[model samples]
Target: MAEKVTAYRFDRIDETLSQLNREDCAIIAGGTDVMVLHKSRRGVPPKFSKPIVFIDHLSELKQVYQTDKDLHIGACCTYTELLEHPLIPTPIKSAIKTIAAPAIRNRGTVGGNICNASPAGDMLPLLYVYNAKVLLRSVNGDRFVAISDFIQGPRRIQRLHNEIVTEIILPSVLEEGTHVIFEKVGNRNADAIAKVSFAGFMRINKERIEDIRFAFGAVGPTMIRSREIEKKLVGKTLPLADAEIDTIVAEFDKIIRPIDDQRSTAVYRKTVALNLLRYFLSLKQ
Candidate 1:
């Protein structure tokens, strides 16, 4: 058996940051992913090589607010909380609904999903399409990074040992989207991990595509989103939608690099991804 790790819970943010300098310590909130990764036998406590600092109880890190330019979702906010909040947009709510069962959603958190850095994380594709950013903090100071840059690759994040993600920031303009769509393909309807998933949104005005976004999960090192590629459809008229859809699909195909995993094959993922893109485009009409 591994040595039992100590757990710390602090009500104050200041007290939490004071203990964050140690490289051997881990930060945990919902324990949704952490507990699974450090699992032991069925009847045994989870095996841990480092101590855990629980921050879910900190009220300072559970805020949800909006400013002139952005919606700030605190790191400790759970999936259930966001689902119930009236301010959350349809695109985000749709994605969160497909995550897991009610019990897991009640405990799993937004920050946990982001920091876990899994390419298949359901929330990631929407976060990428919505122009989200992550707020990282430490005793030294605070900094914000684009979500695309923060989650470097599968199971990898750019956070330092001393830094903790305090919030997930999204552009306020996302709430005004004219249409939104989200879909996750998994083996089972409940508690299944995504084999391929997509989150997209667009605003049409006077029969012209004013704005559009697309992001795909479980099909790349990180969730695949490219602003340069999405520009192809923006400002296009509805009459040109059919032809443009094929062009957009081809553009995305070049960047969606998947690999064979226990859950799925690369070819199946790529085929379904492009098909979903086609279905999403068809809806634009």
Candidate 2:
């Protein structure tokens, strides 16, 4: 017979961290993904045999606030909550709005999305463009890590077993005149996983690119961001000549090596990723 699962819920962060330190357990906050995996195991052996510790009710992990420099979003804040919140940046709002459907959005937490670490996750590319940082906590203490460093690969992260992500920190506001864009290609408009996605932020002053960043999703083991490529574009003038665009496109071709997956072909994803960048450039032209 399979071992029965047990659940523990706590209202205090300290108590939760103490329990995690004492025993092995699986952390669940917004059972959106966890419950699906559990229910799908019909006859198959369960992947998780440990007890579950529920943190969805922890008030400490559900806040959305701002400081002088950054906005802090608690890990348990759901996609629905982000949509309703006034402080969410335009690019992030645009990206999160494309996630699943209304019901899943209501139940899915930002931390759950980050911890799940799906390469196709809609929020990741936005987080990358914003240079967000994740705050993690444990019985020992707390630490902050950049979004890129926090998520090492698909379904893998640097978070320790006893640590829980408490919040994400992002710039309180983008600079004036900055333009942000998010583009996604999927099988369906709603409730569909991304075949390829792109998120970009750029600021132009006097017809010259003052700052810029780009992130691509569902095209690799992890979301792709290239500071080297971004550097080449920053300080360059807008309306890039065809030759310059071709050079940049060729550089991107070398960076992304997608593999054929159930949702899309590698060729299609690669082509779309490049085209998305081209489209963003066109917007400025």
Candidate 3:
């Protein structure tokens, strides 16, 4: 005999939170990754083992609004919705456009993507570069955590079982003349999981590199970014000398640790990550 499953649907945030606080339940929004896990029987803490609380229909978690300093994205907002919204940053838009296909994008929520915490999750690298924050709400209160801190490991996060991610906050203004790039290599073009992915933002002023941020995914336990490496090139002049480029590439090679898996080899992922970074930097000239 199989275990019986119980499901609860709530249209209000408070009601959902109350249920979450009182019972041991899994909170589900888009059900994209969760469903796959439930069907495949893979991953830690097997899916559908406990009661489920569905919050996807709550209007409170489906909004996209902005303030003077930040843009607030609701937890249940879908990728297609974000892509269609004018307030979404261009870099973010570029990245979201590459997720799955139209049908999957229509049902896949940004919050779900973040909470799923896949190493190759397309949204995370951009969020990491943007210095995004996640807002978690529980019956007890609310808490905010940096994107970097929120994701503890592959398929692991800081969110308590009783808390729900309510919003994702990002800076409203990015540096002027910043160039952003998002690149991914997968088994196929559409709907395929990434073998390796990279997102970069750089700004050059007067032929001198003013600011730079780089993130690589599916090459580490979590999305990879190094402030130490970024600091080294911040004030350097562009049209970088071959020696300088080699030095930066060497540093990146040291940091990116990949593993051979079903999708790709460790060697292939590391090679592509470095190549993409080199190509992105070359575009600044």
Candidate 1 or 2, higher TM-score?
Answer: 1
At residue 66, what lDDT does model 1 achieve?
Answer: 86
Q: Regarding lDDT, does 1 or 3 come out ahead?
A: 3
Clashing pairs for model 3 are none
What are the TM-scores, per candidate, against the unseen true structure? Answer: 0.95, 0.94, 0.94
Q: Which window of 10 residues has the lowest lDDT sum in candidate 3?
A: 38-47
**lDDT digits (tens) for residues 1-285 of candidate 3:** 345678999868898899888988887888988987877444444448789998889999999988886999999999999999988888788888787989989999999999999999988888888888999999999999999999999999999888999999987446466778899889887899999999988877888888889999999999999999999998888888778888888999999999999999999999999999888777754
Q: In every candidate, how many clashes are there? A: 0, 0, 0
Compute the lDDT of residue 113 as modeled in candidate 3: 94
Ranking by lDDT: 3, 2, 1
Instruction: Please give the ranking of all candidate structures by TM-score, highest first, separated by commas.
Output: 1, 2, 3
Candidate 2 backbone collisions, by pair: none
Report the Cα lDDT for residue 126, model 3.
86
Worst 10 residues of 1 by lDDT: 171-180
How displaced is residue 172 in candidate 1, in Å? Answer: 2.5
Q: Give the per-residue lDDT of model 1 (tens digit) for 9-100.
A: 87788778888875547888899999998888887888777788998888877898889768999998999999998777766787788789
